[model samples]
Target: MHTSTEFLLALWTLAVVEGLRVTEVVVPPFLVIGQRARLRCHFALEGEVLYSLKWWKDGSQFYQFIPRNDPKMVVFSVAGVTVNVENSNLHEVELVDVQTSSSGQYRCEVVAEAPTFNTHVLSANMTIIGKGRGALSTSAQFYLLETVNFGTQHHPYRAPWHALP
Candidate 1:
């Protein structure tokens, strides 16, 4: 008993709901044992409100962000995963002293609030290598060399040339 105009309006409403989408999930592909790893999850809500943001490792939920909750943030204990709550939020999670066991698939889940309640998930793999095996690639080495600041502007320090004489 619905008119064509009413059906078209309903379709238009759904089309413009502005559902949730995960823009990017950044999980470092490689990390040296004992190093801190920062994982970031970027999301776009369009016109929707965020209901919750969660992080999972190997299918285990480790961190959550609920905007309406009193505490707003919660951390769960998972083997090989240590959450640095101090530096973690809806957009990023920091893991301190990552170990070899930390290697796993990291996933970010975002859910929108209210009538839409749309959800999006994205994941990336991370690996932890022993210190000896974590040598930087040639390109990475060159990047470090090019961007490293040896000293303050008042005391500029060059490389081998500075120590030559």
Candidate 2:
């Protein structure tokens, strides 16, 4: 009977160990292309968590999400991508207009100030699938500006004889 109890205890310990892997963070696996999606990072600690939280891609440096005026964290709105952030119990990162480039491994970095500990980083990987069957649409501005430009002669407010030499 004692041996059976010990075996059960060992099994529970193994389960706990598997559950608490301190490496990569967990985020939603799937997101639609050309749409907004959120990535979350959560850390577990006993005491206060006063630290500078940051994010990065590949081997780049830290990324700041707050204080919009910071030049290091420029508000970049590319043709196919946009980034926004929110800090709370879990850090929420929004990726807008996701494209093929958005599908990659991402990292979440944490620096604990009060504890004076070295920086800790957590990673999460994702894959963005293409929208099938003409799911994506092009912007209308392309057709309006270059292809459908109306000269002043045809304009409703401009008189046709005004520009005649």
Q: Pick the candidate with the highest lDDT.
A: 1
- Over 124-150, each residue of candidate 1 has an lDDT whose tens digit, in order, gives 999876533233553222110113554
> Per-residue lDDT tens digits of candidate 2, residues 65-96?
43323442433333333575442223566776
Runs with alpha carbons beyond 4 Å of true place in candidate 1 = 1-18, 132-165
Ten contiguous residues minimizing lDDT sum, candidate 1: 138-147
Lowest lDDT 10-residue stretch of candidate 2? 139-148
C-alpha lDDT values of all predictions: 0.83, 0.52
TM-score of 2: 0.51
List CA RMSD, all candidates.
Answer: 11.8, 17.2
